[model samples]
Target: MKRIMIVDDSSTIRKLINYILRKKDYLITEAEDGLDALEKLIETKVDLVIADLNMPNMDGIELVKSLRNNFYHIDTPIIMLTTTRDENLKKSALEAGVNLFLNKPIQPNLLLYKVESLLEGEKNE
Candidate 1:
């Protein structure tokens, strides 16, 4: 099974995502923010990351940049989960190497579809 790490400040959202992704048979891991996510990323092998933008100790954009600059996680898939729908932000994220983006108030089916598609693509690659 593919392993996904969810990095969010909200405990409620974390639980919701964990529940939904677990049902799909993906191994789920979580972090409270980008810093935590980085630590987790170093500690284990994660196939994908779903990160929130507005988080303490570090934010999603910074995290993406860090991942690119850091020796590890160069190819790890990142799916930005954010309330900000600004085209500029989306463009910047893509430039930073995010694999996908999911808006806030995420729909379960859509999340599943995006996750599956990215994972499937990775599998094909």
Candidate 2:
């Protein structure tokens, strides 16, 4: 079974993604912020990470940077989810190593597609 982490400050977002991925038979872990997600990652190995950009005590970009330094997560795909339409933020995320982006008010099908595709690519590598 594949494990995934959903990192967001909003409980609703976390719950929604958890529900969506759970239905697809993916193991889910929820984190309220990037800091919390980093802590969780230390203990578990997740195939992918879905994170929100704007978060307290560490944003997604910083989290991605931190994860990239860790040998265990060096090649793990990170999908950043956000409502921000700022091109600068998107550029920063890309530079920081976010593999994909998903806008807020998420479309379930797109999320699943990205998740499956990233995981499949990981498997192939």
Candidate 3:
């Protein structure tokens, strides 16, 4: 089974994504912020990461940069979920190594589709 790490400050977002992916045979793990996500990642190998933009203790861009440096996860795909539509923020995240972006108040079907596609691509690689 494939595992996904969900990094978001909002409990609601974490729960919603966990719920959506559960039906698809994907293993779900969660963190409340980027710092917390790092600790979780140290203990588990996740196939992909679905992260959120704004969070306390570390925002998503910093998290992506951190993950990119860690040799074990250098190629892991990260899809950032954010409420911010600002182009600058998007550009920063892309530069920091975020693979995909999903705006918040996320649509469940779209989330599933993106997750499945990323997961499939990972398998191919």
Candidate 4:
């Protein structure tokens, strides 16, 4: 089973994502923020990460940068699932090494499709 990490300060959001992904039988890990995510990452390796752009301590962009700098997780797929509508933040996320940017209120099916696609792409490579 693929392990996925959901990084968001909101407990509701974390549980929502966990609930959605659980349908596919994915092992879920929840982190309150980027710092929490990074700390948990040290002890648990996840196949992919879904993070919120606005988070306390560290944001999604910073998390992407940190992950990119780490050799072990440099290639791990990262998806920024944010409520931000700012194009600048989206651009920054991409430049910082996020593989995909998704807006909040996302459809569950769409999220599943994207996750599967990214994982499949990784396997192909």
TM-score to true structure, per model:
0.91, 0.97, 0.96, 0.97
Question: For residues 2-117, could you state the per-residue lDDT of candidate 1 as single tens digits?
Answer: 99999999999999999999989999899999899888877888888999877889988889999988776887778998666556777777888888888889899999999988
The lDDT per prediction is 0.87, 0.92, 0.92, 0.92
User: On residues 1-125, what C-alpha lDDT tens digit does candidate 3 reach at each position?
Assistant: 99999999999889999999998989999999999999999899999999998899999999999999999888998999977665689899999999999987899999999999988898887
| Model 1 vs. true fold: TM | 0.91
Against the correct fold, how does model 4 do in TM-score?
0.97
Q: Give the poorly placed runs of model 2, Cα more than 4 Å off.
A: none
Report backbone clashes per prediction.
0, 0, 0, 0
Off by over 4 Å in 1: 84-87
C-alpha lDDT (0 to 100) for residue 71 of candidate 3? 96
- Over 1-125, each residue of candidate 2 has an lDDT whose tens digit, in order, gives 99999999999999889988988999998999999998998788899999999999999999999999888888999999977675689898898899999998999989999999999999998
What ranges in model 3 sit over 4 Å off? none
